[model samples]
Target: MESAQRHLRMALDAARMMIWDSELSNGKVIDSTVKWFAAGTSLLGLPPGDLSQPFSTFLQIVCPEDRDHLLDTMQEAVDKRTGYEVEYRVQWPDCSRHWLAAKAHVFCDEHGVPVGTLGIVWDITERKENEQATARERELAAVTLRSIGEGVITTNAAGVTDYLNHVAEQLTGWTLEQARGLHISTTLKLIDDTGAPIPEHAALQCLRLKQAIGASSHNQLVTRDGRHVAVEESAAPIWSDRGELLGAVVVFRDVSHERKLSKQLSWNASHDTLTGLINRREFEVQIADALHSAKQDNHVHALLYMDLDQFKIVNDTCGHSAGDLLLQLLAKMLQTQMRDSDILARLGGDELGVLLPHCPPDQALLIADQLRQSIKNFRFVWDDHTFELGVSIGLVEINHLSKSMTELLIAADQACYLAKERGRNRVHLYQDSDLRLARRQGEMLWVSRLNEAFEHQYFRLYAQPIVGLCGHGGGHDEVLIRIQPAKGELILPGAFIPAAERYDMMTAIDRWVIRAVCRHVQSVRDSLGPQQAYVAQRQPAPAQYSVNLSGSSLSDEGLRDYIIEQFVEHDVAPEQICFEITETAVIANLIKAQDFMAGLKALGCRFSLDDFGSGLSSFAYLKALPVDYLKIDGVFIRDIANNAINRAMVKAINEVGHVMGISTVAEYVEDEPTLAVVRELGLDYAQGYAVGTLRPLSVSD
Candidate 1:
C-alpha cells in the first residue's frame, strides 16, 4: 500500500495535477465535506485544514465570469452520472487570476445513482494565453482588411476564391459566402478596353508567373448587374512561412474619374474653346493627310483659307465679349454650309480653314464664293448696334502638282491676301503666274532678311534736312531707316517696311530707332566743349530728330515706358526728339495715339502729324489731334508747282495747321520751284531734295 501511494504521488507531481474528492448523499454531492490530495489545495493558493470545503466555498474562489459555467457543468456531470472536463478562470489568495482545467468523474451506487465525485485540477494559464494571442492576431488582420481603402481578394493555390475583404465584396458585388470556393475569374470579371474578356485572370497569371502581375490601365470590371466600372488592379503571389505557394492576393481601385479627366484634356488639346472647332494643329494634320493622298493616290482635294473682313472694327467698336460671340455664330453658320465629309477648323483669330476631299478648283471656287457671300450677308448685332461683315476666301487645289503641305498653305494664304486687296467678299484662286502673288512671295523672303538685319546691325540711320520756311523750328531732320546688305547697295525702307508692318514687327523696329537716336544725341553732346555746348544750348538745339512711328506702334502702351527708359539710359533731352505719325495711323488708333501724344508732350517731346491731307477727313480729325507740326503729303507737295489742285490742297492743309497754331512742313520739294511754292504757301518747314538730300545721320562736326 505504501509503495502504491508513493508511486501515485510521484505521477501527480510529474504531471502538475491537483486532485479533489467529494462525498455525496441522497444521490447528490454534499457541501463542506471534500478531500484534497497531491497538492490540490496548493494549486488554488489555499491552506490545508482538513482541506475540506463546501462546494459553494470553492465556487467563491472561481472567477465571477466563470463561476456560473463551472456550477452548471458540474451539476450536469453529477446528474448524468458520467465523467466530464471543463476549463475556467480562478482568483487565488494573492489576487492573481489564472486559467484552470478540471476533469471530474462521478461515482454512482449500484442502482445508477450518483454518490461521490473525484476531480483533477491543473493550471493552464500559459497555454490559454497563447491561444488568446493567436485569436487576437487573426481578428486584427480581419479588421485591417475591412478598414483599408483598396479592395482585397485572396485566393487559394488552385486559384479559387477563399477570402474577400469588405471592400472587395462591395467592389465585385459578391459576398464572401457567395464567392467562396468559386474560381477567381468567375467572381471578378475583367475585360480589356475593347470590352473583350481577358484570356486569363490576373490572380491566375500571378500564380503561373510566381510574381506580381499588374493589370493595364484599360482594365475594367463587369459587375453582376452588367455595369462596367474602370478599375486599376494588381495581383501578387502569397506565400506561406515555409516558402510554399499559398494563393494570390488581388488589390484594386476605381480610376473612372481620372480616366475621364485624361480624355477631356486630350479633347481640349485639339479643339478651340471659343468656336468649338478643331484648332490649327488639327487643321494642319488634315492638310498633311490631304497632301499625302495627293502624292500617293493621285487624288484631288481643295483647301479654303478664309479671313473675316472688318473683324477688328467690330472688336474695337464693341467689346471682346461681342467679338467672341460673333466668332461662335460664324463658326456654326460655316459648319452648316460644309458637306459632311468636309472638315472645318478655326485656324486663329478671325481666320478659318476648310479641307474638301475629291473637289476640283472650279467646284472649290463656287463653294468659296458661296461662303464669302454668306458672310457678306451676315450682319452681326451687339447691344443696340448692327454691323455688316464680309470674308475674303483663298482657294487652292491640291493635286499631284502640289509640292508639300507648307507650300500649299503659303499659296492659300497669298491667294486670300490678294482677295482682300482686290475688294473683299470675294474668292481668289491660286495661280503660279500671278504677278501679285509673286511680289508677295518676295516680300515674305524679306521678313527673314529683316530679322537678320536687326541682329547683325546691318541697319543704318539716314536723315533728310527739314529747313524752316517761317524760321520757327529749323535744323530739324527727318530720321529714316535703311538696310545695307553684305554685298549690295543700301536697301530703302520702302523695300521692307510693308513686310515689317504686316508681320507686327514695326513696334520692335520703332523701339530700336528711339534707342539709337537717343544714343547719338548723347554722344554729340559729350563731344562738344562746355562753353560751346552752353552757347549751343542758348541757340536752337543742333538738330531735332523726327522719327516715324507706324500705326502698330501708336497703339503700343508699353512704348512710352520703353522710350522713357532709353532717355534715362542715354541722358538725352526730351525736346531733342519728335515722333512722326501719319494721318492714317492717327485715325486708326485715335484714342491710343492721343493718350500717347499727351503723355510725351507733357514731358517736353514734340509730335508731328505726317502725310497730312492723305485721308479724306483729315481736317475733321486735325482739330482733335494736339501736334506741333503738320507735314503735307508728298503726293501734293511733289507737284505743287505744276498742278493747281495740288497747290490748292497744300494751301488748305497749311491754313488749317496755322489756324490750330501748329507748324506745317511740305514734303517732296524736289525742285526750286516746288520750294518756292512751299514757301509761298507759308509752310513752317520744307523737307525735300531741294532742301537737302538723303545722307547718313551724324553728330555735328
Candidate 2:
C-alpha cells in the first residue's frame, strides 16, 4: 500500500507539472475508476457558486439565452460517451455576460460505465460580438438595397444578372426570379436613345471603370414595350470583404417623363400657338438653313412678301373676329397657291411670307402675279355684308447678287411696297435700284406711321355718287377711304395705301370705314322724313352704303359674325347695306367667296360687283357671285361714244349682265353722249362726276 501511494503521488506531481507549464491551464481531468473521484478547478477565475456541487449545477448559472444549447451539447457528449464541444453564454460574478467555448472528452470504464470527463474552457466574448456585428451589417445591407428608389442590379463579370432589387424589377418589368442568371442585355433590353442596341462592351466599360452615366450624358434604356427610356445610371465594381472584385453593381433611373417635357418645351419655343405654323424664331432658323443650302447647292429661290389690302376695314367694321378669320383664310389660300417646296407663313397680322426654293426670277414673278390675282378675287362676307379684298405681293429672287437673308427680305418687302403703290392686288418684282433707295430711306418709318394712324384717327372717308342711268333724278353714294398724312397734304388711296397694306394696317382702316359709314347713315336717317324716306330707300338710300373689302376679309370665315355684330351695334337693318366687291375678287377664290356671299345674302343684304370687266369675268362666275348689280369698268365707259371696241365690249358686257338678270351700272359717264350711249346700251346706273360730285352730307341734308 505504501508503494502504491508513492506511485500515485508521483503521478499527481507529473500531472501538476504538466498543467502548470502548458498553455491550457484551465483544463480538468477525472479518473475512470468508480471508487476514485477527481476534480480540477481553474485558478484564474470562477463564478460565485458551490464548488462542491456537480458541474451541471454550476453551468446553470450561465445566461438563460444560451442555457438550452449548452445543455443539449453536454447531454449528447454523455450519451455518446465521446468528446464534447459547446459554445455558450455565461454570467460573471459582476453580472456581466460573456461567451465561453467548452470542450470535453468523456471517459468510460471497461464495462462502458461513465466515470469522468476532461475539458478546457475559453472566453470567446470578443469573437461572439464580432459575429453578431457582422450579421447585423449583412441585414442592413439587404434592407438598403431593397429601399433604394433607383433600380439596383448586380451582375457577374460575364454580364449575367445575379441579383436584382424590387426597384430594378419594376423598372425592367422583370422579377428577380426571371432576371436571375439571365444575360443582362437580353433581360434589360438596354438601348440608346435612338433605339440602337447598347453593346455589352460598353456596359463592361462602365462596370470595369466604375463610371456613372447621366440622362443628359446620353445614357438610354429600353423598356419591355420597345420604348426607349432615357436614363441616368451609375455602376461600380462589387467587392468582397477580402478586397477582391466579385462583379459589378449598376443603378439606373427612368427619365422618360423629364425627356418628354424638355422636348415639349423646345417645340413650344419654336412654333406658333394660334396657327400652329412656325413662329418668327423658327422662321429665322428656316431662312438661315435655306440660305445656307442655296449657297451650297448654287440654287436660286424666291422670297415673296405679301400684304393684305384694306384688311383693317374688315376688322374695324366687322370686328377683330372677322379679321382673324380673314387672316386664316388668306393663309389657306396662300398655301394652296404655293408649290409643295414652298414655305408659307403668317409673319403677323395681315403680313405673310412665302419662301420658294429652286425658283428663278421669272418663275418668282409668275408666282407673285398668281398670288396677287388670287387676292384680288377674294370676297369676304359677314352676315348681310360683303367686302372685297386685294393682296399686293413683292418678289425677290436669291442670286449671287444677294448678300444675306436680311437683304433678300428687305428687297422683297420693297417690291411688295411697289406692288401696293402701283395699285393693290398686283405683283411687283424687286429692282436693285428700288432696294438701294429703300435701304437709304429706312422705310420702316412708314410702318410706324401706319400703326399711329389707327391709334390717332388719322384716317378719313370720301364718297362717290351713283346716278340713275335714265335720269331717275335721285342718286346713290359709294364710300371711299383716304388717309391723312402727318407731314404732307392729305394722302390719296394711291399714295399711302401701299404702305398701310404692307404694314398690316388695312384691317384697322376697314374697321374705321365701316364705323364711319354707319355714322353717316345714322346722321342721314335722322334728317329725312317718311316722304324722303321712301325716296331715300328707293334711290339707293343713303341708308344703303357700299364698302370695299380686302381679299383677306373675303376669305375670313368669321366675316358673317362680325357684320352681324356691326349691324346690331349700329342699329342698321341688313337691307339698308350694300356691299360692293370687284369681279376679280369673286373669280379669284370663287368657292370661298361664293360661300361667303351666300351666307351674307341669307341676311337680306345686297351685293354689287364693282369693276366687273377688269378681272376673270365669266357668265358662270357672275351667276355664282350672287350680285344684284354689275358695275362696268370705267375704261370702257370713258370712250364709249367713239371707240367701237369699247362700245362693243360695253354692249357685250351689258347684254351678259342683263341676260343674267343682273343690273348693270356704267362708270365714268362724264357727258350727255356717254350717258346717251349708256342709256342705249340698256345700262342700269351711271356713276361719275358728270352725275354729281361726291360731298359729305350736312346734318340737315
Candidate 3:
C-alpha cells in the first residue's frame, strides 16, 4: 500500500496530473493523485454513502455526454499493450468543467495474461483552447482577404502572378485558372494616355526596392478583351518570419468609376446647373484663395461680380425658359471673353463672379467690359422669341492691403448694384475695405467624405449584444457601423447615415458593412462556437450575427448576388446570418424589399423586420414580408414596466408575432423591471443599455 502511495506521489509532481493504477485483479485503484478523483468518494456517479466503489465514483466525474465514448474507447484497448488514448471533458468536484486526455495501458502478468490497467490523466484545457484559437485565426485571415473590396494578387520572386481574387478576375478580364503562372507583365497590361505600355512593373519594383510601390492614375489597364479600365494599384514585398523575401502581394482596385466620378461628381457637387460654371460655394472658395495670395505673396487679383441686366424682365415677359436659354448663351459668351487662367462661376440667381489672378485693376475693368459687350452682342432665339441680355459688372482689385474674401465680394456686389442703378449695361470699378467670408456648408460635403472613406478604408464596425431570454443560447448579435474620420475622431452612423442615404451612398456603405461583418464572424466563430453548433445534439452552443440594411440597398439590383458571393468567399453559412430591414424601409420600396428578402431567403438567410411597429401598416407589410423576427419598436418597449399602454402594445405585438410563427425582440429595454416585463411577456430577446451596451469589435475578435 505504501509503495502504491509512492507511485501516486510521483505522478502528483505535475500539476493537474492524475493516475489510476490497479494492483489486484478486477482493477482496484492503488491511489489517486487528484482529490477530485478521490477513492470511495462519488464526485459524479454514486452517492457519498457508497464509498467502497471507487470506480463508480470515477464515473460520476466524467461528463455524462462523454462517458460512454470514453468507456467504449478504453474498453477496446484494455486487452492491448499498445494502450489507448482519448480526450473528453469532465466535471470537477466543485462543479467546474475541464477537458482531460486519458492514456491507459493494460498491465501484464509474468505469464503474459492481463491483470489490471494503469492510466494517466492530463488536463488539456489549454490545448483545446489553442486549437480553437488557431481555427479562428485561420478563418479570420481567409475572410479578411476575401471580403476586402479591392482585388489582391500574389506573385513569385520571378514576378509571375500565382493568385487572383474574384474582383481581380473581373477587373483584369482574366480568370484565376487562366491567369495562373502568367507573368505580371502579361497579366497586368498598363497603357498611358498616348497608348504606350508602361515602362516598369510595380511588383518587380517592390521586390527590387524591398518596399512598397503604387501605380499612378495616369495608367490604364488594357483588358484581355480590349476594355480600357483606369486602376490604382499598390505592391509590397512579402516576407517570411526569418526576414527572408517570399514574394510580393499586389493589391489593386478598379478606380475607373472613381476617376470618372471624382471629376464629374466634384463638378456637379459644386457647380451650377443652367450654365457650365462653378456655383456660389465654389466661387466663395476661389475668393478665399485669392485673398490668401494677396496677403502672403503680395500678388494682385481682381474679382468681377456681374448681374444680368433685364434678366428679371426677360423672365417675366419671355417666361423662365427663355431666361434659362439666355443665361446659357451668356455663359458661353463670357467664356470666350475671359483668359485661360480666369475663373467664371454662376454664383446664384442671375449673378456671376469672375476671379482674375495676377491681373491689375485696369486689366480687370477691360475684361469686365469685354464680357459685357460679348453678352450684349449675343442673342438667344428660344422658339420664336428673340431676346438680348446685358451685364452690370462690379470690379474690385485685391492687393496686399485687402482684408477678407467676404468683404471684397460684398464690395464688388455693391459696385455691381451701383452699375445697375446707373445705366445697367456698363462695368463699374469699386473702391472699398475688406473683412472675412460668410460660410454655409451643405450636405454635398458628406458625399465626398464618404467616397474618401471608401477609398482609404476609414470605416469601423461595432457590435451590440442581443441576449437570449431562453437558456439554449440561440440569438445573434446586432452589428453597427461607425466612421473613422481622417483626423482620428469616431463618428457614429447617425451623424452621417442620413446624408449617405440622401446621396445614394447607402449601397456602398451596406457592402462595406456586410464584408466587415463576414470577416468579423469568420474570425470569431470558433470561440463563439461553430455556426451550426445548436444543430448538433450533444454540443449546443449557438453563435450568429445580424446586420442592418438601408432602404436604398433594396434598389441595388446586384446586392443579393453580392451577399451570396460574400458568404461563399468567407465560407460562412447563410443560416449563421440574419439581415435586418426597417419597417419604414420595407414599406418605402415594398416590391424591391420583398424581392430582396425572397432572394436572400432562397440563399438560406433569415430576415428580421427592425423597428417593426413604426410604420402605420406594419402588420400589413408583415404579412407580405417573410421575416424571422419582429423587433418591437423602442417606443413600446422603453418603459413598458411603468406605462400600461406601452405594456399592452408590446403584449399585442408579441402575441401577433408568435401567431405568425415569428419571434419577438424588444429594444430599448433600460432597466431590470423592463427586462422582467419583456421576459414575462414572452419576448425572445431584449436589447438596450440594461441588457448590454455596444462594444467595439476589434480585429482580434
User: Model-by-model lDDT, in order?
Assistant: 0.84, 0.70, 0.78
Q: Which candidate is the best by TM-score?
A: 1
Instruction: Please give the lDDT score at residue 220 for candidate 1.
Output: 93
What TM-score would you give candidate 3 relative to the actual structure?
A: 0.39
Tens-digit lDDT track of model 3 for 1-701? 99998776666644556554443354233222223344223323234332333444566678898888876776566545448888888786677777778777877779866566677666787887677556544443563375488777777778898787788888888899999999987787778756897777788889899998966677788889998888887787765433556677777778878888887988898899789888989889988998898999999999999898878888888788878877887888778777899999998888989999999998887888888888888777766767778889999999999888887888898788778778999898885432111111235767788888888877887788888896624766899888887796898887778778777889989998888888876676545555555444344334478899998898999999999888888777787789998989888899998888998888778898899777756476677787998898998888788899988889999998989998899999899999999989898998898888888875432
Order the numbered candidates by TM-score, best leading: 1, 2, 3
lDDT tens digits, residue span 1-701, model 2: 99996786567545441111111112222111111123223322353222344344555567787777766766566667787777777676667777667666776678775556655555677877777556444643664465489887777767788777887787877788888998777656666666666555344665666554322335576666565667766666654453435566667778778878888888888866556666667776667777887788887878888898889999989999888877777677668888888887767778888888888888888887888888878888888888888888888877555688877777788998888878878888888798766644554676776677777767777778887765544346788876576677776776666666666666666666766777776676667898987776666333256787765667666677878887887666777677887777677677888888898888877888888787644677665677888888898899999999999999998888888888788888898898888899878789887777766532211
Q: Which pairs of residues have clashing backbones in candidate 3?
A: 44-60, 45-60
Worst 10 residues of 1 by lDDT: 135-144
Reference-based TM-score of each model: 0.45, 0.42, 0.39
lDDT score for residue 57 of model 2: 50
Flag the better candidate by TM-score, 1 or 2: 1
Top model by lDDT, which number? 1
By lDDT, the better pick of 2 and 3 is 3
Per-residue CA lDDT of candidate 1, range 386-458, in tens? 9898898888999988888888888898888888889988899988865466676777898999999988888
lDDT of 3 at 700: 31
